[model samples]
Target: MNNRDEPANAVPRRAVLAGLAVLAGAAACSGGPVGPRRLRIASSAGDLGAGLADLVNRHLRDVEASVVTPMASAGTVDLIARGEAEIGLSQTDLLGVDASVTALARVYDDLLHLVVPADHPITTVDDLRGRRVSVGETGSGTAVTAGRLLAAAGLTAGAYVRSERSLDNATAALTRGDLDAFFFSGGLPVARIRELSARTRIRIVDLSGWAGALRSTYSDVYVVRNVPTSTYQAPPSATIADATLLLASASLPDALAYDVTRLLLERRDVLAVAHPALEALDVRSAAATMPAPLHPGAARYYRSVKP
Candidate 1:
């Protein structure tokens, strides 16, 4: 099921707009009661965007009288650049090219799962040397980080390594024996990975040993993560991997951005209910982010909560 097949009550543009309109009208009738602070939030389909929208809705339901509209296209960075939207729930890496955008918060971290055929003899990072690997789409965060990871292992991209665009396309090529591995970053319980794993014998490649190198090459904030054994259906398990996810764009109003940061810090438990990936957000970890700078509003909120 695509976006059209979502269950009722799922946040849609028209639906959220209608709600915001009503709130706006009420505020106008109330003679300028600070007005309904409506903010347009956008992101690609998956846990981070949807989960964050839901969290914002519930958290600000009464405080500022607001509504969150989730969009699939016109991604976060683009939204901020074009001003088509006010807030974006995407990665900073995608927005790195644009100076107008800044990160409001690091909603969750992503794990880059290096997936290879289960029967393949590539048991470790060292095995990926001189192999055909699909790094992900060009201009994508996945490929950018994939290059970094490969460099950390002393394998120079476009030389000892091969890269491609997507996992689906890569998976097809892998099945036909055209590619050795592929990479992606998302929340735990990734449906795409699970489906791919079921149809083919696949294993995640481990990078924990290269954690120090990964940090040294990139930023120290990113750490190697273990792809839990229970998460996938591989009989004996395959391998572990590391990845990261980030929030980007300088779209939201400084005031609204501040509120959003404050809301996440204060009501993260509410957010975690919708997506376990965000459960990691805490006062301490909330301020630690990289690649993109934090919104001024977010900085204010973080300063207030620094205790």
Candidate 2:
């Protein structure tokens, strides 16, 4: 079992609902009634998006106009453009890359922690020089955030610090003494980080000073935060880090997107249980979270929502 301890089935616990919606899409594509369409939401299984998939489905179940389909992790831009999934989690950095999809809501932030072996020679993002690093899977938000942050510090992918592997594999490599440092984005205290912490000494590199500069370069989309030492049982108590997380879709119907957004706002408690960070999700800050524009439909909701 991967140290995740989360079940494979647990990843898309909303499979039945999602499968039904997939069928609905196929039916619509095949020229069926396409009546009261079901909306499919693509989320990386076993990731933070997956954790919220169920919460989203539960709230969306009663909406007769549409259904929310949960999907495994794939390309966020592709899924939305192809109409395979109407809603999916997107890296905040993807705002200008495509004009097709739009931001329905602002999900919580994915933390970009620079991890290293406890005794390693690195203490900040700048110290990554002359060492091996993992910037996350290519085409991943991790790569975007890691690359930009490193660039802000005068480095480049595979140039300044060699990117070894994805966050999952990199964590394993780090434990085996193969990687010097790794940076990736995900909900705080993610399973991978927790697993690594249990077996090897690890730390969330502090990046408070450079955050402002990074924000300027990467779009104010990246928020600066401090992951408490308590987050991973590390040595320090407070440490600043970069943020990377957002939600979007190019295919989601404006009305349907509005409903899903409304659904989440109404059921704050359920989402809070999955990730405490969601406690801060709100309509007002939704657009500010994305580097680009918010979905026109979602923008409508945000404007009408007072306070």
Candidate 3:
């Protein structure tokens, strides 16, 4: 997500604006202020975006003031770094270490799903050699992971007949038997994956074996997670996982950031109703993924809530 370079002067300017924005918001609440305390939030295109949008509409409408715009996950990071959006949602791996976006909370874990028909015989990443496979769409967060995982497994780009199409297209190809398998990374209960499971028998190829290779070759952003058979009606399987984090721009005022963090942590029960995945939020480890330093305001909030 940090492929774009951030300008040197942007950070301090954002810091100043955040302070001013706080004063303006305070004045407004006192009955003599300006417009609503508007916050522009950017998020990914699927469940992550939709789920956050739902939270903002239902809970943050009056508490902190906000609006949400959905876009590619990488694009969202660029927006936050440039101060175009005060907040964003992205997979931790995509944010990398150099990205300016700071993580406020680790929302949930997203798993790498290598899906194939249940009867397809291929049981491991090694078995995918010489087979037609969809790695994910070009420039997608999932695509980045797919490439790294393949390289870690000693499979070059040309090792197989590669399809760099959208998950929708890949799902269609897999359903029609035109592709051997495909890769996807997302929280559980992905609609497309669920639809594919219902339409035909499918199984997620276990990827736990590649976790060590991933850590040794790259960063330790990946982990092994067991996908319950109840998730998609397949037998329990092990795979690699990465956290999805709520990111904030450094320019967002410390006060506003504090409020937002408090809201999310205090309102977990409300959020869990929309998506049970959110219920897994562990505040104790929310800031464990140091993709970037914790924003000062978020740090204050976490410290206040810590026992």
Candidate 4:
């Protein structure tokens, strides 16, 4: 009884029409096939980054978005810089280290979680001296921020016994009492941390004191924020926070970038269902990607939407 040329799930015609206004010449100029543009979004394997990629893939039907997990925020940047991925999710602090990428939006904040056993006597960064800790896997954003925090606290390399392990590995090591503490930078209510806390009493160290020192040494990319008591059923604590940016390759076409930015803002409510962290995305602060300049296309979109 129903005969149609396109599939039932095909992108709505209105959405396609909306893109045509800005991307009129994209198809003509692109040497590749005229079909939907293929986009690879680089991110860590199983964190918010992957959730974001899935969100884009589901809603942005104009482009075929795929997730390319390099397992670390720094690796995501590397993939974008190398042209292996067109989009990436990374920490704002790492943006200054790469020039081949530009930001699309300041998606959300990742709080520094210095987790230790609740019963442990370590009360502050100073207590970590001569203790076993994991700074996160090599090339991870956690490693970069954790190292900075330790240095700011005057805990030099030789002051602590250090290991580099992924978040999952570190969580397991801590649960087994193999590690005295571990540092992980992620959105609040991190599933791994929450799950770990449910079974084992865990405490998140407060790093609010080092916020000013980090900003003085680095940039304003670091902010002091509180992880609420409900996050992991632990006492509320303050920590150094950094923005997580949705970035695009500098060479991305302006039209494509504009379309991507537009979709992100327009369909935010729908995307938020996949990950609550997306609920933090606000058009008001989306353009404020300091240190890393906004992509020209993204800037254009923001300007067009200005009231």
Candidate 4's displacement at residue 243, Å, is 0.8
TM-score of 4: 0.83
10 residues in a row with least lDDT, candidate 4: 47-56
**lDDT to native, each model:** 0.65, 0.66, 0.78, 0.85
- What are the TM-scores, per candidate, against the unseen true structure? 0.63, 0.71, 0.80, 0.83
lDDT of 4 at 151: 85
Q: In model 3, how many backbone clashes occur?
A: 1
Better of 3 and 4 by TM-score: 4
Please, what are the lDDT tens digits per residue for candidate 4 over residues 1-307? 2238768778877778989865757766785466787788887866555555555677666677778888577887788888999988889888756678898998878889999999999889999999999999888999999988888888988999999998899999999999999999987768789999999998999999999999999777899889888889887899999988889999998998998888887877776765556777778888888777899999999999998
Worst lDDT window (10 residues) for model 3? 61-70
Best candidate, lDDT: 4
Give candidate 4's total backbone clashes.
0
Q: What is the lDDT of residue 152 in candidate 2?
A: 77
Pick the winner on lDDT between candidates 2 and 4. 4
**Per-residue alpha-carbon lDDT of candidate 3 for residues 4-75, written as tens digits (9 for 90 to 100):** 466654566567799999998998889883445667777655545455545555665443334455445666
Q: Candidate 1, residue 286: CA error in Å?
A: 2.8
Which ranges of candidate 1 are over 4 A from the true structure? 1-42, 45-47, 50-85, 89-102, 154-163, 172-178, 233-251, 262-275, 290-296, 299-307
Off by over 4 Å in 2: 1-36, 51-74, 97-99, 156-161, 216-218, 235-251, 286-290, 296-307
- The reply for model 3, stretches above 4 Å from the true place, is 1-33, 61-71
**Candidate 1: Cα lDDT at 109:** 60
